[model samples]
Target: MTTEPSQLKFILSSVLLITCGQFHYTFLFRAI
Candidate 1:
């Protein structure tokens, strides 16, 4: 499989967003 730099960046950003969302959700659940 061939991947470009932009594609790698997009993947990394999406993964970061998902991880941040999970952390935020966990914090909210604990605070509630």
Candidate 2:
């Protein structure tokens, strides 16, 4: 099965979103 460019973009965006969310939570915890 060949991976399409759109699929790769989706995966990368999802990973970035998760990373951002984790960082956001960490920052909130530190602030509190």
Candidate 3:
């Protein structure tokens, strides 16, 4: 049960990081 939760958290964090990276790139592009 503990392993399951940890796996889920890792997946969520990875997805969030990817999304944040894309948003940052777009924001920078528009600022230029």
Candidate 4:
């Protein structure tokens, strides 16, 4: 199967969003 550029971008953006959310939660915990 061939990968589409837009589909790859969507996956990357979602992964980034999830990582950012995790990082934000960790920072908040550390600050408390």
Candidate 5:
């Protein structure tokens, strides 16, 4: 049960990282 929760957290973090990366790129493009 603990392992399942950890796995879910890892997946959620990865999705968040990707989304943040995309947003960062867009912001940079707009700044340029």
Candidate 6:
């Protein structure tokens, strides 16, 4: 049970990081 929640959290964080990275890249490209 606890392990499942931990796994889910890890997956969520990875997804958030990827999305934020993509967003930042686009913003930087636009600024250039």
Looking at model 5, the pairs that clash are none
TM-score of each: 0.89, 0.91, 0.85, 0.87, 0.86, 0.88
- Per-residue lDDT for 1-32 in model 6, tens only? 35688899999999999999999999999999
Give all candidates' CA lDDT scores. 1.00, 0.99, 0.95, 0.99, 0.95, 0.95
Worst 10 residues of 1 by lDDT: 1-10
lDDT of 5 at 29: 100
* Ranking, TM-score, top scorer first: 2, 1, 6, 4, 5, 3
- Model 6 segments more than 4 A misplaced: 1-3
Stretches of model 5 off by over 4 angstroms after superposition: 1-3
- Give a tens-digit lDDT track for model 2, residues 1-32: 89999999999999999999999999999999
Which model is ahead, 2 or 3, in terms of lDDT?
Answer: 2
lDDT of 5 by residue, 1-32 (tens): 35688899999999999999999999999999
Candidate 1 ranges beyond 4 A from true positions = none
Off by over 4 Å in 4: none
- Angstrom error at residue 11, model 2: 0.1
Candidate 2: how many backbone clashes?
0
Model 1, position 14, has a per-residue lDDT of 100
lDDT at position 30, candidate 4: 100
Candidate 2 residues lying further than 4 Å off, grouped into runs, are none
